[model samples]
Target: MSKVVMYVSGFCPYCAMAEKLLRARGVAEIEKIRIDLQPEQRAEMMQRTGQRTVPQIYIGQTHVGGYDDLSKLDRQGELAKLLEDL
Candidate 1:
C-alpha cells in the first residue's frame, strides 16, 4: 500500500471519517500530523496543499485532498488503485 499522510486536528470529524474510509480500503498505517498540537505545521500544510482544512490527505505523492475529495475518488473507483499503487 501507499504511504498515507494526513494533516489533521483532534476535533475534526472529517479527519476521522477520512481515516475510517482509508482503513476500509486496507490502509494499515497513517502518519498523522496533528496541527492542533503543532500550530506551525498548519502553515506548512496550507503551503503544501493550498487548503486550510483539517484533513489534508496524501496517498503516496498524490494529494488525495480532504474527506470529500477522498470519498469522491472512492466513488469513482480510484481510491483502491491509489492506495495500492505503491
Candidate 2:
C-alpha cells in the first residue's frame, strides 16, 4: 500500500473520518502528524498544502487535500487507481 500521511489535530472529527475511510480502503498504516502537539507542524502543513485545515491528507506523494477531497476521489473512482501502484 502507498504511504498515507495526514496532518491532524486532536478532537477533529474530519481527521477521524479521514482515517476511517483510509483504513477501509486498505491503508494499513497512516503517518499522523499531530499539529496540535507540535505547533510548528501546522506551518509546515500550510506550506505544503496551502491550507490551514486539519486532516490534510496525502496518498504517497500526491496531495489529496482534506477528507472531502478524499471522498470526492473515491466517488469518482480514482482513489483505487491511485493506490494500485502502492
Candidate 3:
C-alpha cells in the first residue's frame, strides 16, 4: 500500500470520515499531521494546497484535496489507479 498523509485538525468530522474511508480501503498506517497541535503545519498545508481546510489529504505525492474531493476521486474510480501508481 502507498503512504497516506493527512493534515487535519482535532475537531473535524470530515477528516475523521476521510480517514475511516481510507482505512476501509485497506490503507493502513496513516500519517496524520495535526494542524492544531503544531501551528507551523497549518502554514505548510496552506502552502502546499493553497487552502486552509481542515482535511488536506495526500496519497503518496499526489495532492488528493479535502474530504469531499478524496471521496469523489474514490467514487469516480480514479483513486485505485492513483494508488497503484503510488
Candidate 4:
C-alpha cells in the first residue's frame, strides 16, 4: 500500500470523512498532519498543494486534493489503482 498523508484541522468534517473512506478502502495507516496544532504546517500545505484548505490529501507522492476529489477518484474506480501503485 502507498503512504497516505493528509493535512487536516481539528474540526474538519471532511477530514474525518476522508479518513473514514480511506480506512474503508483498506488504508491501515494515515499520516495526518494537524494544521490546527501546528500553524506553520498550514503554510507548508498551501505551498505544497497551492491551495488553502483542510484535508489536502496525498497518496504516495501524488496530490489527491480533498475529500470530494478522493470520492471522485473512488467513484471512477481509479483510487484502488492509485493506492496499489506503491
Q: Model 3 clash pairs?
A: none
**Candidate 4 Cα RMSD after full superposition onto the native fold (Å):** 1.7
- Tens digits of per-residue lDDT for model 2, 1-86: 33889999999999999999988988898999999999999999999999999899988899999999999999999999887766
**Residue 7 deviation, candidate 4, in Å?**
0.2
Task: Measure candidate 2: CA RMSD.
Answer: 1.7
In the predicted model 4, the residue pairs found to clash are none
Per-residue lDDT tens digits for candidate 4, residues 22-86, read: 99999998999999999999999999999999899999999999999999999999999999995
State residue 68's C-alpha deviation in candidate 2, in Å: 0.4
Model 4: how far is 82 from its true place, Å?
A: 0.4
lDDT (10s digit) by residue, model 1, range 50-82? 999879999999998899999999999999888
Q: Which candidate has the highest lDDT of all?
A: 4
TM-score against truth, every candidate: 0.95, 0.95, 0.93, 0.96
Give the lDDT ranking, best first. Answer: 4, 1, 2, 3
Candidate 1 residue 60 C-alpha distance from true site, Å:
0.3
lDDT tens digits by residue: candidate 3, 1-86: 23889999999999999999888887878889999999999998899999988799899888999999989999999888877775
Predicted structure 3: clash tally: 0
Flag clash pairs in model 2: none
